[model samples]
Target: MKSLFSVSVLIPVLSISMIFNSWAQNPDFPWPEGKRMALSLSFDDARASNPDPGAALLDEYGVKATFYVVPSGMESDIAAWKEVVASGHEIGNHSLYHPCSGNFVWSRNKALEDYTLERMRSELSAANEEVERLLGVRPEVFAYPCGLTYVGKGERTQSYVPLIAEMFLSGRGWKDEAPVDPYYADMAQLTGMEMDNKSFEEILPLIEAAAENRQWLVLAGHETRTEGNQTTYLSMLRKLAAYANDPANGIWIAPVGEVAKYVKEKRAEMEGNLNIPGISRPAEGETIYLTAEKGKGIGPDIKYMPEWNAFGWFTAEDRVEWDLDLPEKGKYEVWMEWSVSDEEAGKPFVLTSGEQTLEGIVKPSGSWETFQKTKIGELALEEDFNRIIVASGEDFDEGALMDLKALTLVPVGK
Candidate 1:
């Protein structure tokens, strides 16, 4: 007779297989050839080491990486840089003069804290023009100087992220903890993880995690050498390239701009296939309702309850998201129709769209069947396509959060 432990293990194994099959069929971002995730290798500062052995090693492995260059730094290595471009690598702007915060003693004279938005804008444009003139290919992506993105200081400080968003197809930051979510990440501020001075063993876990989440991993380094400070080891890179090249690993490795362009195209396709009516500008005094049936449910536990016309079985990990296309920017009052038993009350949840977020605690509605409408807060949304997500907060315990019926948005001062 089969052992009881064997039977128990068999059930979960079959369940996991089914889940994987379902995901393979309908992924959030359709990667080419059913690849699990994307990887982008990028280097910054236009280091001389990049063109010598860095690009050569990558060429041997059939890998394309992005090199963010300061035009002034490349003047001495023009021929090698040209060969890099001809070899099919991408070039991105790293800004002229490479301004950073005054906190760094070296950058004190060219500090961003002393610059105005107009001055910063002019510098960025000049860098792009110079790069195009020198390289024959316009830099379409950017990496923030020292990963800092602000002008001025104190209350007068303003972020230059908007400037980057307007100028480049994608802008990258350094020392980020996690990978980019292909569906939700802001193209202007993609996270760039550090790969310098790390061994293959140290970076394997990150690659595995990104593959598990089907996210995009953009690894950034300064130099590519055998062994040194702030360097990506050639040995480590060789191992990584071999691992990614194998068909079993299922990774799509390419340059930053290439992966960014593919993500944009895929996102547009997903939005067009949503099939739900787009949210447009309502007449004055009208409210927009996002119903449960219209919203997309993510995670394994969240499910729709047709009888109650709501989404139920919500766990801490579950999320409900909606897409909206607004004609103009406006401030709106936010409300929610939800139901939860007394035992599950006080569970916190957060609703977020763009950079705006509204946090609220779940109120007991006597029973899950009894729905109550409550005004949560107000938010100012930007014009164009916006993705809104409602997810459980950190305080959420082990239980159902709420049965969400609909979300309401009323234009403020309408």
Candidate 2:
């Protein structure tokens, strides 16, 4: 019998009404509706000894993946790292050090914060620069050292939101929690996995389940190879590759970066669904006209919070409006562009319609920056009203030159 997976319960939590039909799969918009899954084989805190076999398996099967390279762990295996990059696998910065940064205890540790912002800049930048120097490209993916999101045991409130919005396509933290809406956490800063003592049988089911759910299953591990003994790690890798390469089994193996890109793209597409019902955005290259007041303001009934950071650590206003039109109901996403006379960094702008909200925070590269998009969650629309509002959150002053460059209402499953 085929392996069983439980997705019904998770589906209600996910509420992905726009992206796929109940039976559709693979969310590349134009791609045919079929079950599409993505699997990422990520090696955490690089282990030199574990190189040959794992890379070989991926290479042999024509599969690509992401490897998280820590400064300490990669030095001894520079050649292998280069080879992996050359072989089409992506190399991502895994932090200079791999401390358990996720825990409240460690976030408060004096030694951790002792590395000031400048030091962090150098540390993370150095890793990217070095990887580029050797691999001919700077990596855009960053995973937290031990997956720390808060400082000294207190959450940053809306802090992580802006940080991820501005930079990095995606990131990984060390947590085994069940999936939540990527919007709540930075879609780029997602959860990852570490191989514990679970056997292949127990582990395989979980991997298969995640694949079935279309969740990006990130496998993190250390010491894939020892001086002489390489048993469990090798076995696990072989199993993963076998499952990944088998499309008949519904597993779509992709590089970690690619998976992130797909998820982000899907999120944006879903956002468009939230903007308007039965009106879908044309494929890229097709132009659409948007009103100055396409996305306006929030409704009085909903609670709204400030979306912090948005630009650099402190650039421009990164404001957002949530729960804007809960009752008007319809699927929609936000697509807009803006230019300011006085360039500012780190400002947040967003639009919320139905159950979804879209955000953008960055300095405009030009008078017109086109095609920037963000995803909104699942939504249901009611009759009678059709307009949605976009604005900064409850806090922060409004922005100048904000334009709804192009907006469209997309119908799902049409």
Candidate 3:
């Protein structure tokens, strides 16, 4: 797994400590040895469906999954839960009563809004003890119930994440939109991508997108039954298993505990010294990329913004932003690649970098896929941590002017 990223060690070997210490978005982040992405198969709530067909299917694929369990939910399946542990799947604490927000209405009796920080800690510890008793294995990983992290309501509300951090190796949250950047992620609050009610086809793109950046993707799921609330279809699971098992995909699919532990160790080693091994820097001239689709930090989220020329064309919702790690700073040549139908020609846009702003007007570019890149005005930039924004001009509505494919920044000649 260490050999997968030669770039991870590039910085220390080159004696470039400046890039190492800073939170640089080094594109060459490594996955496990020879792997392209880190993926964790996880199910929450200790459903009885997990130990049987869930664990059984995971076994068939030679993949291990993390099961975040509730004590009471496992009462009837205690024996099966033990088998799941014996079979090498991880048992993670998912709280004793599984208290959620009062907004759920049905959970008003045991709502998180009523919990105190002390009570939350006690409940979590008691849940851990219960799992250890039933499965003879104590859990090190935790997932927030209903993806909720607070303990009280309104002004009195507080995050119980600190409590979980003290008790567990890592705590995972749900319904997150992006993958984890292991270099910067806090283990105690790792985010999980929701997998409920999704088909393998629907899930493949998420893995592919995360793999594009060589990051960790934790998928949170529930139940093996299909067509029900919070259920993940077994057929879809089988397909996901097949995709992950394929050597060609280069994904390191493991239990969350294993991945978290590995990330912690590897990061610590890199921090210690580059010669400790498996450290490298990302490649130079890496294009700062962005798209219409948004997730967590990745945005210009197409949902909240306007769409023009179809789903792929990126339009402005007032502004679009990208967090870029520029290799060097200077007057860079700007290139805007856009497609326009004759009717939607001449949309105005402003590209702002720091205090410098460059205005550009789009012209017809054949068609959507047949994009044309024209040199827009140049903007000055400083190296490292530059926020570049593309925004709408004074125009009010009338839809987007063109379909944007890519934005490029090339260094200008001295």
Candidate 4:
């Protein structure tokens, strides 16, 4: 299985350590390894239709999937759940109660006090307890209940994921598109790309595309058999089975948890080093930090500040920029690290530029917020300069201010 992934790791090696331990984007992330492989299907909500009679379908066909389960809803089907585990499907925590609201709510004391984390862990633990009790195995993968996109925004309600659980499982269902950021252990977390009743015709094309691109795809579902016929899903499974089983196609099927495990293994091999020349040269044991300030609200934590953009509205007083430069023209992956606790009490910073942007929230806790890193984007270098500039995307009140830390640039060794 490790052999199939080598195609993805093609960047410069020895230089990785320098990238990881820097203040800019760690160029060492998304360690290039093995051929481009796409993760197969995944289902959310622990639907009743899972572990279909076609339990062996994915593995027999060489495909893998992650099943985000809400134990409260599927507690009665222990046998079916066991079969799913026995057959090699990955089970992930989707929150104990699947609270539709309060998805982004978090607290500094989550692991120690919040019910969300405690209940989530308990629910997942209990589910794992049940699985181990029945199937003799414990589950690890975890998916956000509502694809909650947290970027250091809002009050203490925002749940902060402790580092202790970082390696628990691959992160899943973060969004509905291909993930480009490697800041996360498993950034490929996607949504609704498959289900029991969806047509083979509808699902096959996406699978084919992901395989061709060596990308990961996630399919989400709710109450699959709880409401519809199983034939379409069965047929879709059969088709997927064929695609996964065909080694010539280069598709590796595993549960989301399994995929996360694989990523952890591979990343461990590279050991958190990014290898881009010139822009960022992170040495081993170094770290990068990025900050986001306030502006017009884009989502929750993200703001639409024009001061950072070259085109946005801002004068000298409303502007902030970075000091960095690219070496050559080619593909590049960029990441920015951010800490919410660093902002002034009750103050959140809005960071942005023509292409780079982020927002960080400062809490009243006074404790420095932990680091949350994010990949900015992959750029096609067209020129070179002494120092690249990163500024605020928009203007803010004169009283408002944005801070600076580090800017990293990586030349994608494409």
Highest TM-score against the true fold, candidate: 1
Ranking by lDDT: 1, 3, 2, 4
Tell me the tens digit of each residue's lDDT in model 1 across 173-220. 999999998877899999999999999999999999999989999999
Question: For residue 68, what is the lDDT in candidate 4?
Answer: 71
Q: Show model 4 residue runs off by greater than 4 Å.
A: 1-35, 54-64, 102-127, 149-154, 160-167, 179-197, 222-232, 271-414
The Cα error of candidate 4 at residue 75, in Å, is: 3.8
TM-score versus the correct structure, for each prediction? 0.70, 0.54, 0.61, 0.50
Output the number of the lDDT-best candidate: 1
Tens-digit per-residue lDDT, 109-138, candidate 4:
332223444455555566666645655666
Worst 10 residues of 4 by lDDT: 1-10
List where candidate 1 sits over 4 angstroms from the true fold: 1-28, 272-300, 304-414
Ordering by TM-score: 1, 3, 2, 4
Q: Assess the local accuracy of residue 259 in candidate 4 as a C-alpha lDDT between 0 and 100.
A: 56
lDDT string for model 2 (313-355, tens) is 1112222222222233344433344433235434444444443
For model 1, what is the error of residue 247's alpha carbon versus the real structure, in angstroms, after optimal superposition?
1.0
Error of 4 at 97 (Å): 1.7
Clashing pairs for model 1 are none
Residues forming the 10-long window of minimal summed lDDT in candidate 3 = 4-13
